[model samples]
Target: MVDEALRAARAVQSRLRDLPSRVVIYLILAACLFPEVGYPGVWRKLTGALVGLPVAAPTASALAQAR
Candidate 1:
């Protein structure tokens, strides 16, 4: 649903060099899902899941700026 909403809003289409918008959106969703975890914790969890993927996790600073 979030993916669809982002797509509808054209939020996924961007020229940014770092941190794809979809990744940022998913990170936000993950943060919501694990409210007990702080931002760093959420990022660790997200990066864990992303480990097998071809993409690299965004830095903490990049995530903050993306938000």
Candidate 2:
């Protein structure tokens, strides 16, 4: 279902699929307020507190690539 929406919205990432575009968008939005925390930190806080992220927490490099 998510993939279908991604396809419809043209939001999907490249073929690597190491990270999904939607997740990156979510993190990017969240990062606006906590820019100092950085992507990995935001990821830690988000996964630990906010949404129970369905996908595995991406590495810092992967997160950067996703963005």
Best by lDDT: 2
Per-residue lDDT for 14-43 in model 2, tens only? 766645677777788888978999999988
RMSD of each: 2.6, 4.3
lDDT of 1 at 39: 66
Q: Rate the local accuracy (lDDT) of all candidates.
A: 0.75, 0.76
Q: Candidate 1, residues 1-67: lDDT per residue as tens digits? A: 8778888887776576556777778778888999887666788887776666776656667777776
The C-alpha stretches of model 2 lying farther than 4 A from their native spots are 1-9, 13-18, 50-55
lDDT for 22 (candidate 2): 71
